[model samples]
Target: MKIKLLRAATAGLFGIVLATAAHAQKSGGVLRVYHNDNPPSASLHEEVTIATLMPFMALFNNLVIYDQTAKQNTDSTIVPDLAESWSWSPDNTVVTFKLRDGVKWHDGKPFTSADVKCTWDTVTGKRDSGWRKNPRKEWYSNLKDVTVQGDRQVSFHLGRPQPSFLGFLAAGFSAVYPCHVPGRDMRTKPIGTGPFKLASFKSNQSISLVRNPDYWKKGRPYLDAIEWRMVPNRATRVLAFSVGEFDLTFSQDISSRLAADIKAKAPQAICELAQFNIQTQLLVNPIAPFDDPRIKKAMMLAIDRKAFVDILSEGQFRIGGVMEAPPEGVWGIGPEQLADVPGFTGDVSKNREEARTILTELGYGPDKPLKIKVLTRNLPIYREPAVLLIDQLKQINIEGELEAVESSVWYNRLLRKDYNVATNSGGSALDDPDVMFYEAYACGSERNYTNYCDKDMQARFDEQSSTIDPVKRKALVNKIDHDLQAAGVRPSIMHQRGNTCWYPYVHGVSPPQNSHYNNWRFEDVWLDK
Candidate 1:
């Protein structure tokens, strides 16, 4: 099944496409789909935020990409995309990348090292960039310089080495932008060398994509077109799925009752894939009462993580820290360590008793209730976990009031550190420990929306970035996780199974372990005849 795509001979290839159309599968086609959120601003730059960016990213290309498969939860599985191959220096601080030749952006311009250099410099080197205010600035701040060798090759010089550099590339934010455009102007129009080209985008309604005829990969994206419709209601999306209106849909609203109903009827229509993502966590804010070790210990004991997972997560298992490391790779914490965390084993009675003892020893009793407001989003899955947590906190004489807020306001309040506790979910940047640790736990990371900061954790995290040695890097990351957990930085309730469903007819479609959203390489997906 090895096929070479020759750009110089595209007409010859088109001749073959015309010749093979009758016998082979149809060429240059499209697929129709739907989503719930409005199309984010038409920006190929890193500034815009929209689920619609997925389709646009697919049309454009990135420096590197995820190896689309099921086991992407751990690092070391990513394959190359724009950069044909790469190498690390002896100390692991410098990364030399060889760019792929003959790749073209959707606008028909050749992709080269210039675009790569521009992309990196815009996101990391700019004096006052869009991401400057983000907490995760630490992740990019360490990048010392980017060296462009030629049109086809480039290298990154780090002030210190970051082992998880590849994981950073795998994120959708790492998608390559055109060199012709300045950083500020790119926020409005995103262009890449991907499989699909943006056809049209109507905010909050629908977005369409057409097959990229000049795409480097051959025999891909079997569908002629793709349509993404933003349908907000979960019930409506499910109904649309049932009626065959969509080939794929994104949902964090997988309910046990819905799973049961699917099992009972239309069994073949539903499929599920869950990953250890931003499940729900009662992040212990490191201010005031929580800053006291005794209070932190009492709260952990008083709260039952098991009941939340069992009753609300619907039997989803809790994971310690973030990495559910798979065996046989460059990085992993292994299954044994994953199972040994205190509240990770799903032992409700034990955890409850432990909480009670800790709180009792701290001079707190059922009569002296510990009051805390639990901030939660209005989404169904989030609300379920919040309600379950509130009920469980009551068992330990903790009065947890559920303060449900709209999604936008909730995020604002979270940034302001308004609540004592809140429920949040975060997926790994496709199998890389660096994505999770750097983006979520890094002391000043933008995504570290929680105000919790540990100097030791931050220093160690920064050290791991530049440390190229595998053993040393792992040790540093593990230490960061250990110290943060001891500080009750954020209590991760469960390593939830990230789930996705598609119609049975949708063949050759698999979800990535890195992100909860639809993966980018949909070029090979075709409806079964």
Candidate 2:
């Protein structure tokens, strides 16, 4: 999973044909896109799903961003966006950035180092006013403070040396917010120094973004405007796309099956399939019955992970522990290593037999089945796997009724810990351990929807985060991955392999390979039509 290896792997996996400048890069067309659901809000800091990132990411600019031209994104590909340049202290505990001059927010407020300090202060809970839900607060847990030296100089002091700190800032979710704008106002009306500005947002209907004429980057954001229409039904959305209603599909929203159908219906479209590194997982609430360790173990043992892969992806997906597996994943363990983890072995019959025995010993059987509702988002990606999970649970006398809710409602339920069992997916913005472990699995993390916590595991998380040596840190990550699955801490079913397709006219775009969160600021996207 070295940088070179990851680049080579992703280059082949992405299968993208970069739009060349052979033809004059014509501008001024509205890039119409199909959104899967109505996003809860436009605030990236408060929401955790791609529902918010897809349409709203263009409205803001990160301090640093992954190279837009690269097919694969790694630490090496990180490039400055708002910041002109940056330097790290000799001890590596403090990093400073020289901000770009002449940058102005859409509201015409001058962008400065104070804005950077205000942004991190809001993110890390230093400011008096805070976001209602800072889902990624843990990403900055190592930061000691943010200080401003002058209008164009900002520094971030860390509690310890974190190698992946810059990569976190490069994430689409890591866009810098303005000092004058509060989090409440940002949820609906946001102002940023990006290539696009929000023109209109109609609840549950559509969002429109117009080009920023005075953007810092000159003559960029080739499209005059971007439009997203909310289409909750997958079949209806695909049908609309095939008939030339939408020019592009939402990032990582199309499945392989849907991609094939689109090609058949609209042969002129371009499609690319790759591992999104987002894992579909099962989360058990810390309520009664599930509070018992035996029940958790039995539930994990009963799950047939391969069945999920075979049925869901037509056997195109890969199975792994908490981290994404092998070549495509930098910190992920190999298949050989994953085989040693519990509930991951090939002997499905033996695993299910043990699961049945455990349930019987706990005084539950087919005659008196244990009934529970399986909660999931009302999207096909989540609903389909949830149905499969329920069928698998029947082997252990666990009767699960699937309860799929809207995207926003489902997330609210997860935050409130209001469900007994749920099937959900966790996507990492970066492939680094610090971003994944801290945000998703660390004790008391806002994104830890399962409410699973272990003091020892948290200590391991810290150890790996601070360790600068790649060799040593990877060993620690591997151990943590194994322990998570062995302890049934939100058992991961499979890593998804999804597709992104667009009409050939939609140019200068390549969906990120390792994550679905980055490379979305469509500054270079121009329609040939």
Best by lDDT: 2
TM-scores, all candidates, are 0.81, 0.95
State the C-alpha lDDT per candidate. 0.61, 0.84
Q: Worst lDDT window (10 residues) for model 1?
A: 1-10
Ten contiguous residues minimizing lDDT sum, candidate 2:
1-10
C-alpha lDDT of candidate 2 relative to the true structure: 0.84
Superposed model 2: Cα runs more than 4 Å off: 1-23
Compute the lDDT for candidate 1.
Answer: 0.61
- In candidate 2, the residue pairs with backbone N, CA or C atoms under 3 Å apart (3 or more residues apart, or in different chains) clash, namely none
